[model samples]
Target: MRQLLQRLNNNSLYVIISLLIFGKGLGFCLNRKFFFYPPQFAWLMNNVFLDYSMMIAGIGLLVYVCLPSNNNFVLGVLLAIITVLLAIITCIEIEHVIFAGEIEFVQNAISNSAIIGFILWTARHYSKR
Candidate 1:
């Protein structure tokens, strides 16, 4: 397990996770009805603007992860934006748990938190280069 983890570098992990997020964002934008929203989150049920914003943020995260780290300023700005967006999403997931009393929302909350951690790890790796 340790060897497998050692082989998975930060950038590769970031790209893989970003692709998953991109897929989720695409699904959110293209088929909002497919997702199950608790009554408390009714505002998220058919919010096209939020859906597109998520997709755009996913795209931005993908681009940020893939781009060369030649310029720290651009990468830092992107990282900040991505971090804020992800934090917001994670907060919403936590809110769902609080408002709806659903334990399942914890999975999404944890996943988003992990993604944020990976993003920060990747950023740290790049900054060290």
Candidate 2:
């Protein structure tokens, strides 16, 4: 059961992240025609900024996991934790978006993607060590 759960965790996480990013993209695409409001625009802008930041961090994480560096497992783990926390906080802000028009799908996508990416990256890198 534990092993099965671990396996599913990555898959589900991936789905969640895809959904979140998709939602955000959809929101940006539809903001003008569908949800034309200042708050919505601001939310989308904030979401984009946050995602860009996360993308940079995500790249660093990729390098950290893929490279044969020294014992940076602690740092790697910390980064993953931080990403998870960001996802949670982002989700709250996105909840309002969803209430307005189900744009929170992007949050789910972002969170799931980050979670799965970090977990698999860490597991593969560490297990090899």
Candidate 3:
């Protein structure tokens, strides 16, 4: 019974992580329209590489999460990659606010930070198992 419960918990965690990755990926794909049209986000408008990289990373992470494995090292590496990407994005948003005097991107930065926190928490949860 304890083993069954543990399996259920792990499965649920995977599902939650998968959902978050999918939502974030979809948001990245859809937000291109908004980023392109907005003058405040002009810096990101021409950066197609960054946009594509984000989508690819999301897909890769989702695939990794779906795989049946108990390897913490691989998970940690993936999380680190994601953290770096998000940090880069957050820094860009902060730069926009500082240079353009726009506070709109601050919300994005906050959201990114929250996601990072959630990822860390998820990693810690898995490490305990």
TM-score of each: 0.67, 0.42, 0.68
lDDT of all predictions: 0.66, 0.49, 0.65
Q: Please, what are the lDDT tens digits per residue for candidate 3 over residues 67-86?
A: 65567777677667766777
> Residue 77 error for model 2, in Å?
4.6
Model 1 ranges off by over 4 Å: 1-14, 34-41, 44-46, 61-69, 127-129
Candidate that scores best on lDDT? 1
Ranking by lDDT: 1, 3, 2
Error of 1 at 47 (Å): 3.1
| Candidate 2: tens digits of C-alpha lDDT, residues 27-88 | 54444443323464655544555554455454444444344444556545635554564555
| Cα distance off (Å), candidate 2, residue 12 | 17
